[model samples]
Target: MTVVGKFLPLLGWVLAGVLMAEPASCESWVDLNVGSELQRPNEQTVVDQTALVRLNTRYSAPVGITLNAHYGLAHRVRLVDEPGTGIAAAQSTGADLRLWDLPTELWRSDGDTWVIEQNLDTLHGVFYWGAQEFTVGRQPISLGVSRQFSPLDVVVPQRIGAQERSYRPGVDAVRWRNPLGLTGELDVGWVFGQDNLLFARATQQWGTVSAEFTALTLNQAQWIVGLSTQTFAGDWGLWQESAWLHDDVLSGARITLGADRSVWSDVYVVAEYHYNDVGDAENMTSDFFQKGLVTLGKQHYVALNASATPSPLVNLNLGLLHNIQDADTLLLGNVGRSLGNNTQVDATIEVPLAKQDSGTEFAQIPLRLAVLWSTVF
Candidate 1:
């Protein structure tokens, strides 16, 4: 079966959903980006032997447009379409239909409601549902402790021309939010398809803190578990998230802690530390969840990130990151401004300092530059 093999179900779901709703509002956006990157692929190492790895340099430019429409049919059903940029299989587009406030008037106590949404693409089939306020499906999941990218969910890292990794798509799942007794939420997911993979995840909150766990079975063969948390202090926001991965034949772990505090109004600083311990170093960067055991480049790092909005259409971002264990470091700065009601341009550059006797990837003189233009209405 090819990649399209997984899209049929999603198509049917979305079409059926659109049919049940009436179109009401529409919006669309387009993005064009081109950039160059030098990537280093890891290889087997031998003691007393030197393995020289060279960077593979390349450039890519892609254009994508997404158009979405919402319909209010019978005051309960809504139609939606989220088409793709058609550049790559990983980022293909799709559609969906959502039904809200169905046949549960008695169960919808004051602040409670029920809804069901479905996607119309085999590559992304989602069965949406919820009770009193909780909903579940095979949709993409983003949890705590993440920056430009997520560390706990490190399955895929690049979001350029097209998607390249497997997304925990919409699946058979259940979620109950602020149920009759609980305060935060409760979710259970059991997914199975093509490759015959199974996954389960759950999350809850205590006062100002939230925690979660996720388990997955590969090809219905190996099992892995993860634990994570998020909280806020008096003047700062803090988080500690980690995963303990174990299969019948392998075991590994990863953890990251970060905090942000405001010094004054509209100005703040952020810092974080990430650690990894992978028994097989080769497994590093397999997925978002498997950073392995050693922080890639074995880093104890911190960053000072700040941003400001000088006008309605202009903004700036700056940050400096340094690794404590190695002499590796990164200096970042970027600015973005809107050109029109629906179009904007932005550029960013990352400059790396030379290594200091410590063999770290960031210590090398690595540089990345890029510009992007996006528009929507």
Candidate 2:
């Protein structure tokens, strides 16, 4: 069937929601963020800045609709991107996966030392029909159970060094959810961006543990079978997510096992171990940029993270990533404090423990310092 034929049914439900929505029952809000980053490599330094806005509205009903839109403008000076990789390229796929991207960059400039661009990042809605739910337009569809790395997150994969955690870049797509009893649900989705993607997940809650099974195909070029589970034991929580990827681009098994616990009222810690057999350990390839393989040129990795809330308004987080094959490590840190009830500021930094010419994962990545301020109104 043609694309429109598939969406005709979803549009019917959207029309139903439009006729049933009451204006007085609508809820709306806005959020803004401004950030500046300093990226220093062994060779040069680059400055990146951005301002982002999110406007959200929701109408309450059995068949509800939510409209969330994001607008962002980015300015970057001094281009020192690694070969075949850049932040703009990683996020270009945001929007709908089964159709097209919503990030319609209104205008952009590219130069040897500077770049400027703006776009609409997110625009999507949700509606329900009896026990079934449908989401359409542009939205973030994140899937994973791992804390540090998730091999099964093929929908909207997160960047390893990305500082923004508040938003999962939106993509264009349509999704459906059907409840299976009280503890289980079946999810199915389609995204068409650079390529067509179709995926599904069936989840079930067994006692205190939740487990999910997943399958996805990307433009007939790739196929993946995945599994994930989450459970807690006493004060310690544990989870695992794994996937077996098969494709002409790359094929192999990837997995991560993780555990976390609160050591005290103010501190929490987590440790995770990841391994993959398909990644090329000898070369710093753009596999992540081109093929969405986040193994990062290594077969084994260890991640440790901790968070502390010393006061009501102050918070700190630290993360350590070790690439086993390359013997290089990277440390990520963030400190934040509230300026008021509706405003906050955060400072983040990344330090690599290896020389930039060492051909290691962290070695090639530059040291980064960023400051971000956000407010809600």
Candidate 3:
């Protein structure tokens, strides 16, 4: 269907949700963002501009029902023949898991410069009883504990290089949560549509230490067993998460060890090491040519991120990713200033310290700069 045709049904749903609840009991939000990115991997430079609009509506009552929905529209214009892997799809495991083949791309300009896409990112109903909560419909399901790399976030793994990491795209799923007293909880989720998946996790805390155990199955295919823990030692925060993945093609473990600390007020740093044994890096840049690749090329890697708020309204951050096996590295830096009024602006740059034509992992990533402006009301 046309983009407009597909979006019509979503608009109706959003309106119906708002109208279903008393005006006083309804809550709604809208977010608008405009982002521009420049890539200069080689002599041929490219510029891409994207504008996104999101609408979120929720209705809750003490006795009746609760409904929530989210919708988004994005318009993008970029130079033709440029190389890029869609960042949105990269951040979403559900990009490959939806049962319906409904593509979000609405339309494209004749000259290949413009693409319009819209998605019903969230449409879920919530039920609450005492300390138990259940959510059904398409919703966001994020798992795991690691920051840069997540071994247990099988449902929607965050991309390591995503510029905007505030939101996770929703997948068709059902989730249940129950508190096991004040220090622990049991969480479960099931996803369907493209492929199916089921997982359950139990989390408990003791003193300043916390731990989790998870078991997950990929419908008819793979199984994952995971364990993770985090604790504080005096002034430092430490964490480790590891998972064993088993499938027809591969069986191995992915592990991550991380630490974070604040040296002083307004300054923080994080370091992590990731060891991926189950992924194949044979074709290192497969996604560079084709999109939607689910593989880890280099096995051993390290990531570091540090940020400092110099003033009440200004911030600076730096990050690094190094491939231990290949000696490839990527350096990242960004600056941001709060504009007040629930709005912000940020500029970021990434420099890959390897040759773009090399077989090494980070080397093939191009130099990129991006600026983003966003507001919520």
Candidate lDDT (C-alpha), each: 0.45, 0.75, 0.77
User: Cα lDDT for residue 201, model 3?
Assistant: 96
The alpha-carbon lDDT assigned to residue 299 of candidate 1 equals 29
How many residue pairs clash in model 1? 34
Q: Please write out the lDDT profile of model 2 over residues 1-377, one tens digit for every residue.
A: 67665876888686666756655366677778888888877666667676666666655554355555565665554434554334443244422353543354444455334445565667666777788988877778788788767888766677675545555767778899999999999999987665677889999999999999999877766788989999999999999998997765566788999999999787999899999766674432433335563545578899999999999999999999998877889999999999998999999999998989887778777988889999998
- Predicted candidate 1, C-alpha RMSD: 16.3
- Which residue segments of model 3 deviate by more than 4 Å? 1-24, 41-43, 79-95, 101-103, 282-295
Tens digit per residue, CA lDDT, model 3, 151-259: 8876665666664566787777778999998999999988776567888999999998899999887765677889999998888999999998766655778899999
* TM-score, cand. 3 vs. native: 0.86
Per-candidate TM vs. native? 0.58, 0.85, 0.86
* Candidate of highest TM-score: 3
| Candidate numbers, best TM-score first, in rank order | 3, 2, 1
Better model by lDDT: candidate 1 vs candidate 3: 3
Candidate 1 residues 121-166, lDDT tens each? 1122222334343333333444445442233453223331111134
Model 2 worst lDDT run, 10 consecutive residues: 87-96
